[model samples]
Target chain A: MKRLVQALRNVERHYLLLLAPLLVFVVAIAIYPLLFSVSISFFKYRLTDPTQTKTFLGLANYITAFQDEQVRKALANTLVFVFGTVTTELTVGLGLALLLSAETRLMQFIRSWLLMPMAIPPLVVGLVWRSLYNVDFGVIPYYLKLLGFDLGRGPLGESATAMAAVILVDLWEWSPLLMVIFLAGLKSLPSEPYEAARVDGANRWQRFIHITLPLLQPVFLVGLLLRTMQSFKVFDIIYATTAGGPGTTTTVLNYHIYTVGMTFFNMGYAAALANILLVVVAILSILYVMVLEQRQL
Target chain B: MHRKSSRLAFLALLMILALLATQCAAPPAQQPAAPAAPAGEEASQAPAAAEKPFAGTELVLASMTDQYVAAFQYLIPLFEEETGIKVTLDPLGYVDLYQKLTADFVGHTGNYDLMTVDIVWTGEYAANGYTLPLDDFMERDKDQLALDDIMPVSWTLGEWEGKHWAYPLAGYANVLNYRKDVFAEKGLEPPKTQEQLLEYAKMLNDPENDFYGIALLGAKGPAVAQDYMVFVQQHGSSILDENGKPAINTPKNVEILEFFGKLFDYAPPGATDYWWDQRETAFRSGKVAMMEGWSIARAGYENPEISSVVGKVDIALAPVAEGMEPKYGFGGWGIGINADSENAEAAWEFIKWLTSPEIQKEWIRHDGAPIRRSTLEDPELNQEYPWFPVLLESFEKGDGDYRPRIPEYSIIQDALGTTVNAYLVGEMTAQEALDQAQAQVEAALK
Candidate 1:
């Protein structure tokens, strides 16, 4: 009981010491702005209006944003991009990680090289891909033409394929980070289970299916959750590549908030839109965590 | 196993050290160098400022023009030398400048001694006394400041509800861009009227072969709103009636919108996505034979790597619509002083040298877009750069053009863009699009 008391006192001291500074910082920078924005979302406020009062209009701004077709389109685009990129990246990244785990001498160097894209600024990566996707001067078209296919013009900014192109850029830039994490987990895995499976006369494929898959579940689920969250909040790549063009086909939820609030100076509407976006992301994150946790168990 | 654990610890330590290095190097690396020199005072002459009347005072003048940064920095030395006031120039882009100034107004900070404000932002800033009156500065320094020498209209853009808020700086307009080489190759002539321009666009287009006849802004924002206003004006319709009431939908306006909507057929495939740079890029790449854009694109077109028909590119007056009047775009910017300035007198001294006829002349030579009536009308100046004189003549003759002078202009523009882009992309008929936009704007206006 005396030991327990000392342990509790130690835990309490450390908690207060760490919690005070972190809470203060969070309240000033993150929580304060978040709450302030929520309050502002209920008003009719103009950034430039000096004398006009920010008249309280409960839920009017929220209703207007919800009814906006542009907002709906942006929300739809965001969902499509997040799901499309996250699933593909997770699968491809896991596949690459497994392939990389059985590698020979250059495996470490190859692993490091694969991380180059992640190291680059997302905006620069978007710009490089923008050039690669350009119809007239891009190498993407050249290679496709070599294989007898024409991808058409201005694909990144075009209405038919802009959202897809944004997803492609995000996948290209972030898939490597997923690979690194999975590879780390794969390298650290014990060999005893696999040896036991082999002793039971299990084939390579069966061993991988029965042992490897089940063992890698924790790492795989963690990767999925991280990728999904990151993909949902993707902005710099979309902004750089498309700026949401061709009748707003590429206007993701974040981009919509930016245009409506920052560009148009509709702070109240933007705040409402941001809140909706937060709710959406929060719901997706919850689902992601639950599924990952269930899979781990 | 012990070594492996130690290696993991080493790798973790390396990452920590890398992060620490990054955090240490980040701040000074990101802070934009506060404008390197004061406006209008040449930097080399700052040492001589100690002898002048304003010896001990400090002046900070801000302007928005990275394009003319080199030329503006030249004045820092001379102005500091003659005025005995240390001057600091805060240079930024149009959008950034607006946000900063607006935020300053809200905070009532005297951060900037002389601030660069969009002349139209004058009413709110000036009326609220966030900006200082320049009348006293002008009167006291008559020998240095020359208002009569500046373009009258460009100068008046600084005035709001009958108060002088800014001095004219750089002025240019969105004009019709046509390629002389393409016209000759295609055996077509420049359009004299808006109807003819549309017809020419149809003829010049060959989209299947990777060529667009023209490029136009289809997005909503300042850009689309500005272009829509110009298009409507060219066809003889005004967004705001002379009484300053919302008046966007009329028969003539509907016809104009329909004409532009149909013209979309000849524009680039993703033309609705293009902004000023994209339009310039498309035209420069020779993907489009003609485009309606800002007048200063003559400089961009001059670049050999970009333009497919640089040597063959030529300029002509924009095609007038059915009316004889040309619907010129409100496409220029001016400068103003912040009212909360502590060193207002010293800043005014620097502003004089920056906007004076002599400095304006030098700017014309350097900046490509200087705003002064004398610079615009000089025949000798026209003889050197042929486009300058022609643009000046057009600026002199241009009339009946305006932007949304209201603070709520951005909302109206958003409504305009949503409707215009929807129509251009074939979502709705021209009449329907205009009606929807008009309705949305009117509702927002209330």
Candidate 2:
């Protein structure tokens, strides 16, 4: 009993022992699922069939994914969504952050109100936007017609515009997160460089280009990495609104994975698709981290 | 200082343990007091109720959120009163219910004692041993249940591999719902043939007035697949050939697809994006003159809150091919005991009580879809639901198994749904889409 108490005392005194529970939790929840998913990707398993055992297929699932046209289309759509939402969000978010940089009463109020859209759950955002895009009773289409815009079955109903409509919903829900990040970045920026630029006869635009943007490179990379990763995994909005409809124009990679895994019960193939998504996200994250590190140096 | 900090840490741990102990002890005291009085009263009145074979047993039911399930909640208290079994109802959305049920069954968690199974899932569930056969239970309680009173079509829903896996709860017959007023003005009879229906559609189509002739399901996934099956069956073609092989690209199927494409021109402009709710909304909002809908939605057409076409609509069996006999689509839910359930006997008792003829009669009064032939024939029920007779006729003639009940139905649905949607959106011709679907479905089946 004395020896047991001494061992306990030693662990308590280490301080790092306090983190053991959290470490175990992370390993159990995160690392285990990741490893399990990777292992499942190497098999041919269908959840629906009880008689069939999981057959080991090596990299056959991955090879099939590369050859699958639907998967390729979904990958292309995912890239388009990530590029479209990230670029537009960064541009608009930077502008809003710049405008709200002024320390004033109304700007403060507007800054707080900008976060309302972000507060809404993504599924609810999808549902609300779906109603707003409805052709018959939707407020947007009604007013667009009144304003003489030829919508032609509304944006979501047409193959040509469904992707754009979905991107717009993502923009509405997520742009505010970028704006908040950029606002903090702008405030934390050194004013000494701007003062020096002005002394050198640099105008506001020149100062912003040379001084502000250079200083904000790390922040920009962080925002890009976060938004890019999120946009690639887009599912709930497409699910609630378009359901990958209008000829599969809005079927992003995550939605495709869901359909393969849940809808079709192709668990092994779905795991392969998921691992591919993880690789893409990891590469993007590493690239962003490298750029940020370079900027820090 | 080190000694004092260690003492503080020890005291905090003691406090947390004490708090948890208090919480663990609280529930039992609160639970027993509420049921004691009624239990005592019932004990004196009915010895069986007092003895309670399954007393303290709790049964959890996973169900899809429907009007019937909502009304069924009232009976839970009575069940608890008589059987001394606590019932927990977990109602989820249709898709979510299937996913949850699948996960629970696959994991063998025994989380759900009962599940409301879709008829289409009977084969998959039974083959996987996810559901228990109810034949033994039925035989034991034969006289009490009166299994013969259920509609024959309803009985077929529960039978897979020559055994009963579930008891029918709700049965729907797919019907063509049309604007009666529009048909009257055009001097049109409800068309009995697909060709006549298309001709009538062309005549009634008025885009300027925001009235489309038909509201076809063009949404990708199960919506389009289900709607397409109705047409495929009507054309005297099956998804699988006579040899039970993929025959989705048959000449008859191709003809139907081409005809469906032509019909799409007269449907609402965004019809390709519509699902079940959207299609029903199109009809109820008076945007479309006609649509193929299930019998379940017929009651909603007269509800003043959401419907603008009240008293202006009529129902009929879906039109068949020119020379073919008429057949309607059949679909609905059934309740089954989970094979992994620990309280199977208690769950079986609950199922018996829920499906009893007396409860079923009362059930229909509160928006429940009927599965019993006797309920449809009851004069009082007929007076309330005038469409019951038509529903019964459709039930007798309808083919419930039009959509294959195989384990591969989901994969087949995905392949065909995507192809059909592509054709509807003009991404491919009917032949190309059907060919592609045939190849994909055959590959999936293999």
Candidate 2 is graded, for docking, as acceptable
> What would the DockQ be for model 1?
0.16
- Candidate 2 local lDDT, B190-261, one digit each (tens): 888889889888888998887889998888888888888888888878988786666889888999888888
Per residue, candidate 2 scores C-alpha lDDT tens digits across A1-297 of 454345446447555367557645655566556766887799897777675468899999999999998899998998898999999999999999998879899999998999999999889999999889987668898899789888765688777898899999998888889999899899899879888888899999999899889888889989999899888888999999888877678889999999889977888899999999999989988987887788669
Models 1 onward score TM values of 0.82, 0.89
- Show model 2 residue runs off by greater than 4 Å: A1-16, A290-297, B1-52
Mark the 10 consecutive residues where model 1 chain A has the least summed lDDT.
A3-12
| Deviation of model 1 at A252, angstroms | 2.1
What do the candidate models score in CA lDDT, each in turn? Answer: 0.69, 0.82
Index of the highest-DockQ prediction = 2
Best TM-score among the predictions, by candidate number: 2
True contacts kept of 1: 0.12
